[model samples]
Target: MKLVLDHIGVRVGRSMHLDDISLTLEPGSFNLLLGPTLAGKTSLLRLMAGLDHPTSGKIRIDGRDVTSLGVRGRSVAMVYQQFVNYPSFTVYENIASPLRLGRRLSAAEIDRKVLAVAEMMHIDKLLDRLPGELSGGQQQRTAIARALVKEADLLLLDEPLVNLDYKLREEMRAEMREIFARHTTTVVYATTEPQEALLLGGQAAVLDAGRLIQFGATLDVYHRPASVRVGEIFSDPPMNLLAVAIERRGSGVVRLSPDLSFPLPSHMRALPPGPCRLGVRASHVALAPSSPADIAIPATVELAEISGSETFIHGRHNDLAIVAHTAGVHSYRIGETVALHLDPQRLFAFDADGRLIAAPERQPGTVSGAA
Candidate 1:
């Protein structure tokens, strides 16, 4: 079933939880919603599932207006991070409870349907086990099996993999994608993890402070962010933002910072600017052993972190703290003086209002000092 949210807003007590959010989910499409805490990602899911009524606007399912419909009236099912299962019931009983309690089905039919979903979820061996006996992952799979056995039209997952370890999370992530692909259920997924968003959903919607920031294809939103906030959201090390003043020098030449100067790109030369923020991803910044004349800035490494597959080096330039990430291993040490160079061509500037500005053109005769 296709799900459409139009101007949906939810208010709890005096505070607004979701504000004028709008999205349309194509049938069988996986839509990922991401945000920080209090961003209303889960609130939107609850509204879509008919668990909570919107204070304003409408929610439509398959062209039918279901804004005021109750949870049971809408064919939507939700599986939350905390697996909701009956402690006293066995796995078979938990999976069969929905059918027994809500729908009219014969004993033989309920058993057949329960067995089918159990097999599909790989939880057949745990049919006789209670919820407490199963591991967290197994319990979650049972909850998912309960939903699928009912053949829900819309599947709402609220950070279903959030509690698992990295390895189990990865394994369940693949399982979820495969199950959704086979069943073709309209799905709305909510998560704070950017990697999970990109891995599960073809399209992603970013929410900030209860407002919808941007929504589009995952690659489009990641590579070309609409604003500085959008750029800072998806990346691992986060986007580096620096405050600088833009000054025009010698006709069309523009001085971005006091020490760093370059000619403005043809498009940016016409803009009026005073104070601007430069946004660059951590991967775009590099360190050079020898300081180049024009592009490199002197910095002192304050700290370095070495993970299994990546290394993060934290350094300071003037009053700004910057971080750079590299794969595998790095040789930088704390208190070492390093020359940091930013890729000017890949550098992005945003005005005080958070609007992105085009990078200036590279100098014709000058070569880039660092990679």
Candidate 2:
């Protein structure tokens, strides 16, 4: 089954919850809606699941307009961030409740379905355990079993791993991916975690302030963001953006900064003349023994952090504080003078309007610079 949303919007007084949201999900594809807190991720999910109606526009499933459909009318199962199992019921009874309450199966059928789901979720061992008896992770597994037992055409998960501890969350994420691999149901996962979005999504939509910032394949969103905000949202330390003026040289070389300048690749040379931002990831910011004559800026190391696998050096230059992460142990004494070398080809150029002007063309070993 296919799910399509077209120009759907929801407004609440002075606040617009969703603005012209549009997306089409293929059958069995795992899709993610990701954004920062209060970005309306949950609101969009609820609207898609028919639990809430948009103020305007439509939602269609298999070409049938379901904008006015109620939650019960839509063939979807939602697993929420909160583990809402029945406190008084055992794990077996909780997993079987959906089957029993729906009345589509006999007692024998319900038992078989419940057992199968429990086994798939690795919760069969806790069949006799109540919600209180099981740990947080087990309770979440039971809730998931219940969701899967219903056999809906679409699976809706709203931050389903948010309630679990770090280790448990990782484990459950792996299990969830396995479950998706075995089923052909369309899955819409909502999360604020960029890593989780990449891990689970075949496609993803980046939402910000109810606006669809960008939507496409996971790698596409990361490698070629639609705007500066998008590039900032996908990296850990975030993409390092610096203001740069485009100065025309006889041969397409633009003066990027007071201490840095590089020839505009053939692609960016003919582009419109205007103000722009230069972006590079932490990994691309190179530190040399001294500033190069062509381009270099004096910076003072603010701090140096060693985190086992890599070292992070936070420093300041030209009134700009920058963070750089490199593999293995590196040493930079606090308050020491240093110079940074940024890869010209690795830079992303954005216009004054914050829209992407030119992005780094992918080459081997390029890290999608910062979220």
List where candidate 2 sits over 4 angstroms from the true fold.
265-270, 286-298, 303-311, 327-334, 364-371
List the global CA lDDT of all models: 0.79, 0.82
Each prediction's RMSD to truth:
5.0, 3.1
Number of the top candidate by lDDT? 2
Model 1 scores what on Cα lDDT?
Answer: 0.79
Off by more than 4 A, model 1: 106-112, 246-256, 262-274, 288-295, 329-332, 358-371
All candidates: TM-score: 0.85, 0.89
Local accuracy of candidate 1 as per-residue lDDT tens digits, 1-371: 88889998888889889999999888988788877777998888888888889999999988999999999898878889898898999999999988887779999999999999899899999999999999999999999998888778888888999988788899988888888878878888888877777677578898988999899986566655678877777666678887776666654444544565666545466656577777777776776522232356677999889887777788887777888766668877788988777655556778878866665444464322111
- Looking at candidate 1, the ten consecutive residues that score lowest on lDDT are 362-371
- Would you list the clashing residue pairs of candidate 2? 232-371, 233-371, 234-371, 235-370, 235-371
Q: How many residue pairs clash in each candidate?
A: 0, 5
Error of 1 at 83 (Å): 2.1
